[model samples]
Structure formats: structure tokens, C-alpha cells
Target: MGKLKLLIVDDVEDNRLVLRAICKKLENFEIKEAEDGLEAVEITQDWLPDIILMDVMMPKMDGYEASKIIKNLYPQTVIIVVTAVTDPNMQKNMSEIGVDTYIHKPIDKELILFKLQSIGASIRLKQGQFKTLSKKNALNPFNSDIRSFRIIFDITDTESMMDFGMWLFDQCADKDVVACGRLDLIVELFYKLMRQGMKNQENLSIIVEESYEEIYITIKFENIIVLEPRMVDILNAFESEFIVQKNILCAKLKKYIEEKNSNFEAERTTLTEETIQEIVELKIVKEIHTAPSKERELLRQSFTQKTCAADYVSDIGGDIVDEILDLASLDEEWRERLTTFEEIPSDDNLKKFANGVLDVYAHTINSLFEFTALAYALTSLGIFLKEKAHMVVQDPAKIKTLIMLLENLGYDLVAWRKHIFELQDTLDIHYLDSSFFSSCMQIEGIMSNKEIDVDDDNDMEFF
Candidate 1:
């Protein structure tokens, strides 16, 4: 509740005046003015501001360099880039230099106030001064010097999980620990993991450790189910481009199986000699239909040859076969059965088998998507805190590094979205549920407001 500090950095006197006027409209803000980035840095070094409204283009040193310098010195200070430059590349560059938020020129008064209020709320939350309810319960009292705590639960115990989450929040609240939304993230992650079919009796453990400088939490589980290969790809969507391609391939494979099944009865009776000759020429029977090889090279060769031969049947027939083979290899029994078959199985059986395989893959993919959505949700909260939290600010170096990771993740999410659309177009199937992408969209909604419910119990609110 102390007076929040504000630094307005702009080269133009008029621009500075405009920003100053905007800040005055908000409550309890002590304002400072700087004409350029260099002066901004100097002012920040002498007097650390809680929030800085900085213009990108300036004389001598640009806002980009100034912001970087100021952030390097004071990572806790929130920097909002106010500029007329709308070029995405420039905006991205600003983000790289540790700018937390952006406000374009011809700023609306309402937007400015909203941004200020949002940042203020985060700062108060971090400072551990923001209180949501008056009633105090006789739970464990918060301690500033406490270093660590551990809690364990049965995976199926939702009540225990909720109780633990609430207890953790209460401890932080009592201690005035500014976790920068980490508490919510931990609870949300637990919810997601539980929904992903964690074994009933498995142990889910959380360890929270704090130092004078940083607080760290780690969640662990023993006897947890391992992720399927497809799920692994989806979880790694941020780092890899193969997820969309894999999904597209899977859909095509499923369609191919369906088509082959429908035409099997007819092809069985009216098969032509030339059709047989083409099959022979493609050497499908010789290369892939023969003895199965355990060697990876042989499998790769078989996949290539079969896929190439399948191309003669349909435009993407080869790709479909390749994907089917790849998917079947995921299971040892299916791999052996597929290798031993003299010809493609009866249409009905093949269709059923392919559908079964795809169902499992889809289920795993859904779980992975849910995991990622929760991660993004957590990151969105972190992004909010990065813009607002002053207590327990992370090391400036670490914050910069995390900002880079966040930027990369944002780009990957966009790529993933575009790839999903492309897959839908190609397969005429909507593999991704609407909720998958909508969860990410919710991040923006979260950042704009202060009315999120953080307590599992209905009696208390965190913000």
C-alpha cells in the first residue's frame, strides 16, 4: 500500500507529459521523468521504480538499450514499452530486451489505467500485503526464515490435493511470500496430472524450498505411467516441428485403412494381371511382405518401399502405409503380426485394428495437449507476475533467460496452431479439441483482470 514508483521515459516532452498525466489519474503513484533511455537508466540506478513506461525510439540510446540496462540492474522493475512502432519484428526485439508489456501510441486512458492497476495488483501480491479475506484460520503460521516443506498424497486423493494447495497458499499468504503465481501453477499442474490417469495408489509428492533469494518447488511421482511416444511428441511441440506432421500422417493412415477395407471384397474377385504386375514391380511382397527384420535399417527400408508402392494406389497411399507401419511398431505384438502377414488383412479387421491404434494415440495426444495447456496457463500467470511482482523478484539474469524461453514458447504455440489447421485441411478431420487452443487464449483474459479465484475453499480469495 506504499506509494508505487513510476518512471516515464520518452524523448518528446509532449509524450512524457501525456504519460505523466496518465499516471496521475491512477492512485498513489510517485512519478519520475526521463527524456531518453540514457537518462532513464541513470534515473533508475539512483531511484528504482516499481513500473516504467518507456518509449522505444529515443535520442542517443534507444529504449531497447535503456530498458535492457535498467532491467539488468533492477529485474524486479516492470517495463512497459510505449511506442508507435507496430512492426512485429520491432515488438519482438523489445520483448527480447525484457519489456514486460506493450502500449501502442495514441494510447487510450482506460487501457493505461487498466495496465497500471494490473501491475499494481501484481506488485501488491508479490509484496505479500494484498489480503483477500479478513478471517484467519488456525493453520500453520507463515515464517520468513523457513527453508523447505514436503507433502505427499495418493494420486487419487483430490480432497487431499485441494487441502494441500489451500494450505500452501495460506502459508505463503501468512509469510508474505511472493511466489509470483507459482502456488496456483502448482495446484493446476497437479489437477492436470491427476486427470491424465495417474494410478490410484501412486505417490504424488511436492517439495518446496526457499532461499533468501529464490523459492523453488518440485513435483514428483513414483510409479507414474510413462508417456506414449505420440504424447512425448505433443509435449515437445514447443521444441519440435514433427508433431503436426505426425498427426497428419496418422489421420491419412487411418483413412487409407478405411478405404482399403471398403474395396477389399471387390479387389479380391476382379484383381487384374496388370494390377498384380504393378504390385510385383513395386516389390511390396518381396521387400516388406517377406521375412521381417529386427534391424532398424531393414525396417526403414521396408517402410520406404511399402510407402512408395502405396503411392501407386493413392496420392498419399505410401505415406499412409508408412505411418501405419510406424504406429504398429509401437507395440511388439502388433509389429510381429504385421511383419508376418502374407498380405494386408481383411478390410474389417484392418480397419478395426487401425481404429484401435488411432484411439490410443488420440487419447494420449489429448492428454499431452491438456498438459501443455496447463503449462501455458502457468506461463501466462508468470507473464502477469513478471509485469507486476516486486517481492521475491528472480535474479535479473535468470528472468532475462526465462523471458527468452517464454518468447520461444509463444512462437512454438503459434506454429502448433497453424500446423493443426493445415492437418485439418489435409485430413478433413479435427484432431485437436477446441478447448486445447482456447486454453491458451484464456491467458490473455487472465492477464487483463484481477478477479481470479485462487482458493480451493470458497471462503478465501488470494487476489
Candidate 2:
């Protein structure tokens, strides 16, 4: 694509000057200046700039009215709004008006540059060079410039969930880590819901859409989701991760693609709910989840009042898990200890491994949303390792596998903490319970050809 034609629309001369200086840092933009939203629309009618940086509190005509008029006039033009930190309603108002994105006051240069660069790349994707669906699809950006893909899968069973995950990996594996990571975050949220046995026969629809400097992962749930803060209220989730409505939950990841010779990065921005509504086109049934917390957690959530066909799967309790504390530092401690076990397979190291895992089990039990799967898996590994420390130290090869399994087990625990516990991510943690515990059983058979049973009674005996 040619250089991005950018228009900076701010009534204040100083504000326009500063934005001009920042836009100068990026070489791709062929820039312009619009004194107000009216001038912006006038310029669009005559010159048609690719992107517009609009100011909300303008004199002649405000950005809210201007953006709506321009979107209706030329649906293809991208309008990025500027909002003050003091005004809480400015962003929400702009979103309702259908502006592509909003940049907060005390404007950061890096963020603006990233946004422009991403818009430029999406323009490239729109022209039939990269992946292209029909020009009129509800999910795909249709103004001949939006870049995105959609996936619809029913989370009714394990087999379907696995297929959904593998398919997602296939589509996003080639994209950047941020792209894959953000999508994984979305999957984690879905997995937590499905693991709770909320199996609606109607498939959950997800659209991974990219806009100027931002990526949107919007999921449409078949049934209404109910969430009331039990403890800590997660604030500003709308800015970084997810903005939850009733059935449709929108999660986002910020990205800025720096064009390096031939390669480019991935990016995202906000999309109007009307656009989001096109995904499943379900009517509004308000069930709210209002949390604005620094450390995001799903204290308690459930599905309700699903109006699917009679044959369609019904709602179940989606008891989302909340973390007691961060596991990074603790997980790091065990990670180094695993390396130590590799160097010298000693009983001391073995005890450390067992205790370390058991410590995680303790945390899992105390979480508001119960996870017995984790309880059993962590306890079984910890107790079994405590008993077999002597035997494991004797065999180097067996200890190697033990160390490997332990490493994976610790990694999964932290993954749950970071992905599932902290932010929403992939559902792999659900499968990890069976897989990791089964590996622990293999360790048991290797030691004494004995079958070990794990239950609430802590009734585990060896031959």
C-alpha cells in the first residue's frame, strides 16, 4: 500500500502541533491537519484521508456527531478519537457512535505511531493480498480495508474443545506471539466456562478482528452470562482485556506493527457493538458483569436464561476460578529447583519438588471457584514424589523423566495462574489435570508396578 493519509483534527493549535511532531516520527504517513470535526468531514469529502485523529470537545462540530456522520457517509474511512482522562463517558460515547478507537489524553507518541502502522498494514490485507473472505461478511471488516478471521465451535464436549484448540493453533501459529497469546487468552476464558459444564448446543462464535493499532477477540455466547463481583472488582478490563456484556464478551490486545524491510507485526483496536452484533445477531438481553480491578479475576460467574432451541444444550454453572496470589515468584523457585534435580538426583531435591507442587495444591483449594481436578493432580504428585524420592534418585534415566514431568507440571500450574487464574486464556489446563495425573500414575507403576488411587480421603497406599 502507499503511505497512510492521516488527518489530525484538534481545535487547539498546540495539540495539533504536538501530534504533528509525533506523526513525523513515522515515515509511512502522508499527513494533514483538520482544525475541527467539521473541517475533518470537509477534508474527507474532498481529499479522503485514510485515517483521522479526531478530538472530542471541538467547537464547530464535536467528534461524536462528526464520526457518526462520516461513518454513515463513507463507511470505509477509519476515525480514531481523542478523549481526556477526566471524562469517563467520552470513550463509551464514542464506542456507541461507532468510532474505530480512542486515544486517551496526555497522548503517548509510541501508541499513536503503533496505531497508524497497524492501520496501514490492515489496508494491505484488505486489498486481496493476504487472507480474504467475501467483502460483505458480518465478522470481516468490509470497507475494503479491515483484516480479520472468524471461528465458530460448540463447547459441548472434550472432543469438540480439542478440535477448536487445534484449529485455533493452526490459524494463529504463524502470527506473532502477541496474536497467538491474546487468542489463547480468549480460549482460556471459554475453557473455564465449558469446563463448568455449560454446554449450550449452539456454538460459541469468535471473531479475531484487527484495526488501527489494536486487535479485537470478540466472543458471542449462546446463553446469557451472569457475573457479580464476589470480592475484588477488576477495573479497566475494557482498556486491556475484555469488556463483558450479556451474551457477547469482547476481549482486546493492543499491538503496533513496525514495518521491518519486508515483515510486519500484528495489531488491534475497538469495534462498535453493532458490528459485534453482526456475529451472531442475537437480541439484547441485559446481564451485566461490572468489575474494574487492576488484577483481573473471575470470582463467580454462571450461565442463565438461555433461549436456545429445545434440542439445544442447556445452561450449567460456570464457576470461574479466582487466584489467591501471583504464582510467578513461587513458580520460578520451583523451576530452578527442577534444574537442580537434573544435576543431582537427590532425596532433598525430590522433597523440594513434592512440597513445591503441594504448596500449589494448597492455593488451588482455597480459590473461590473450586477445582478438585487440580486438587487431586497436585496432591497425588506431591505425595507420590515424597514417598518415591529414594527410588527416583537411584535411577538416573527414570529421574530424568521425573524431572521432565515435574517441570511440565510446574509450568502448567503457572500457566493456570497466568492464563486461567490471572487473565482469560486457553482451556488446556482442564486437559492438563488428566494428562499430568496420568503421568504421575506412570511414575507409580515404574517404581513398584503398583496402582495408586487418589481421592479426597488421601487414601494412597503403595505395594
Model 1 agreement with the true structure over 201-261: per-residue lDDT tens digits: 5556543322222233444555444455634543443232122222121100000101111
lDDT of 1 at 242: 20
In candidate 1, clashing pairs total 0
For model 2 the TM-score comes to: 0.37
Which candidate leads in TM-score? 2
Instruction: Give the per-residue lDDT digits (tens) of candidate 2, residues 1-463.
Output: 3676888999999999999999898766788998888898899899888778888889989887888777666655767777664354654454444455556677767556545654555554555443533334333232333223233445555545554444343233222213322332344444444443344455565555432224455566777764435101321333325556667766555442311111111111554454455333212211111111110111111122223211111111133232333446577678777888888778998788667756565544433212433453455556667777888788877787667766766666665555444454443324334444555555665666465443312321111
In model 1, residue pairs whose N, Cα or C atoms come closer than 3 Å (at least 3 residues apart or on different chains), thus clashing, are: none
Q: How many angstroms is residue 185 displaced in model 1 relative to the true structure, after the best TM-score fit?
A: 22
Candidate 2, residue 402: Cα displacement in angstroms equals 36
The RMSD (Cα, Å) of candidate 2 is 21.8
Against the hidden reference, what TM-scores do the models get?
A: 0.36, 0.37
Native-to-model Cα distance after best TM-score fit, residue 389 in candidate 2, in Å: 51
Give candidate 1's whole-model lDDT: 0.45
- Residue 445, model 2: Cα distance from true site in angstroms: 30
Find the 10 residues in a row with the least total lDDT in model 2.
293-302
